[model samples]
Target: MPGLAGTERKNIAPGLAVSIVLKQDQRTGKLTEGVVKDILTKSPHHPHGIKVRLETGEVGRVKEIHDEE
Candidate 1:
């Protein structure tokens, strides 16, 4: 599937491209795209979104995952 990454812990992995909402941007719902550097959320699922750190060192909650074509 293309661009199908989700909030489930299993859906996110290191190196995958994804869009995330930084803590500061939650109100505006801005999405930042980057490769997954680390998965910060340890739960199986999250209502808002799984927290992750991008390769650029920006930390945020996964809002949308980008599919690498």
Candidate 2:
């Protein structure tokens, strides 16, 4: 999917690289890239995006899921 959704957890597994918008950067729409550490959103779908914590310990909503290859 282009935009991250809560239901797309399978598409965004741990260790996967992704771009996200941090709580502070929501206004600027800044994208932070990092490896997924944990999935915080339990819902199947979120309007904004699936919230997750990166390996770097940065928490944010997934904006895009990057391919491994």
Clashes of each: 0, 1
lDDT string for model 2 (1-69, tens) is 554443466667898889999999999999999999999988767778889999999999998888767
Clashing pairs in 2: 7-44
Instruction: Specify the poorest-scoring 10-residue window by lDDT in model 1.
Output: 1-10
lDDT score, residue 7, model 1? 71
Q: Alpha-carbon error at 43 in model 1, in Å?
A: 0.5
Superposition error at 12 for model 2 (Å): 1.3
lDDT of 1 by residue, 1-69 (tens): 245556788988999989899999999999899999999999989989899999999999988887677
Candidate with the greatest lDDT versus the true structure: 1
Q: Cα RMSD (Å) per model?
A: 1.9, 2.2
Residue 18 in candidate 2 has what lDDT? 91
